[model samples]
Target: MSTLGGAGTPNPNKSFEVVQPPTDSISSLCFSPKGNYLVASSWDNQVRCWEVQKNGQNVGSVPKAVMSHDKPVLCSAWKDDGATVFSGGCDNIVKMWPLASGGQLVNVGAHDAPVKEVAWIPEINLLVSGSWDKTLRYWDLRQQTPVHTQQLPDRCYTLTVKHPLMVVGTADRNLIVFNLQNPQTEFKRISSPLKYQTRCVAAFPDQQGFLVGSIEGRVGVHHLDEAQSSKNFTFKCHREGNDIYSVNSLNFHPVHHTFVTAGSDGAFNFWDKDSKQRLKAMARCNQPIPCSAFNSDGSIYAYAACYDWHKGAENHNPQTAKNFIFLHLPQEAEVKGKPRLNTGRK
Candidate 1:
């Protein structure tokens, strides 16, 4: 419900608001690569797109489009060039949309089971989708059929493409990095050190490495170019009692070398990728945050689908705290030659 700037502080001077869809959990949210608009999907089986105005205003107009699905829409991603968008839902299908217009959904069948993740790779005009059917399918927008499909050992929850490579995370806590440059070869699967389910995965913008989040409140950072013997940097995130019911969403900053994560405990934390340190912990929510994304300028924004009753829920009421975007600004540094007060008595 907010956007934070590079410094990880909430920007009070600027903000934007989107009309909240019907009461349902937000399954996914995405910012267009151009940063002029945003799309949010919910368990209510709706996808709503909004136009972002200057100074953080949502324009108060109706959504560009409100697409419907048979089941909850789970995830969404925009093409690198912002020409198209891809979305998946519980209906077990991946759909493509034209961004120039108000996103008209196009059916692209890939799995017999519910599709869990959908990612658009603008570099090659390809779309990668994962599903509960235990498979990853690659689609060429120019063709009506999937170009290739890889059967996985377990249900794949998340997927991302880094040019000639694609990364897939499974429910079994395994991470597989595939070299698409040689599509004829098998994928290089790497078993992560995570003990529980791998809930989410995000590749660095530069594609040097990727991070994986688990149900046990842990985040593991893996390097792609390093030797297999190299150790992954792991960090415990939430409280002991607040074990991650779901590490559902993750996003990298557009400018800063940091990333953000949200979990079922309703907590969102920003971490420095190079240092592997937690930079800031935003306000915890009453319900789990299903999805989040950053703007083109590195502003952080997130949406939560409240499912539980707690203190965080009280503060997040639609009537009182209904802003859909949080703006975080860098705190100004104090001048070095500033005047100082003296405690000496005359």
Candidate 2:
């Protein structure tokens, strides 16, 4: 395939621009709901927002702002409207930044330990955060007190939310699913199908179930209805020479139900959830990808290639640790294929 930006054949060699912020490794990257901006948070204790060219102009590194946190900001999320942002970090604090009111963080809530993830649900006007403290806390932007809190069996590792359904994956290999209508109650609980630590979870676009990734390069496709879950299966990726990489991140395409995955092996891949077939895999990257996301409109896909401290010391280099954000204009074929045949699902 030609490497230039054309149709579904995007030129991989030419990036919109390269970013080298965050003296330490980048932890996450998320595009604004507007699709014209992206924000990244890092271990360096700063969150940088970059301007993205939606019109396909010759782009360069255009950073809009730098916000500070006391410790590594593990996650950054944009609200449904795209003007406000939420961040949580190792300092156990969750903050809200209003772009229109002058980019100042309002201390919203805190966890007992490092905050691992933050997810915003516009439907309920609610924000949910998970932590190593082994609990999930719900917050209302209009109030300082948490709306509700639910304790988990172990440290909360990953959270996946799709409208009325929310799923939490924790350190105890517990998979907890909840109905968002009643935030504090648990809907179902099951042991993780994977043998290793939970690395990531992404809800299916239709909310049928979710995809789970682990440190052992394994991914499990699950369905809420066990009858439909007969097709629930596990696959492996991120395996390089003599090493198995953690499946670091997963995002489902909005228009197409297919999903994209990134891993510690410094790789990104596209897959069809129904047919259980991989559509494409990018060239191996120079650093592990910690997180990835797609804009609400699905025109752009973004990912952060940075060092992961949790990987221990085997394959990381402090000298080479970077804050590399990648942008790709995914063609229809690369992200989606023809409608997968049902082959007669009962």
Best by TM-score: 2
Candidate 1's C-alpha runs over 4 A off are: 1-17, 56-62, 227-231, 240-246, 308-346
lDDT of each: 0.67, 0.81
Give candidate 2 regions above 4 Å deviation: 1-14, 57-61, 313-319, 341-346
Candidate 2 residue lDDT tens string, 122-166 = 999989999999989999888888988899999999998998889
lDDT of 1 by residue, 1-346 (tens): 3321112223223433355554565767777877667787766787777765544433342467667788888888888877677888888878887867755678876588888888876666678888889988888887768888888878987876767767889877778887767654556788876778787788877877788887778888887776842646788886536343556667776666477777766667777755545667766654455567766775435454344222344444443322243333322111012233354845
- Displacement of residue 264 (Cα, Å) in model 1 is 1.8
Model 2's alpha-carbon lDDT is 0.81
Candidate 1, residue 60: lDDT: 41
- Best candidate per lDDT, number? 2
Candidate 1, pairs of clashing residues: 2-325, 2-326, 3-326, 3-327, 3-328, 4-328, 5-328, 9-328, 11-327
For model 2, state the Cα shift of residue 217 in Å. Answer: 0.7
**Global local distance difference test of model 1:** 0.67
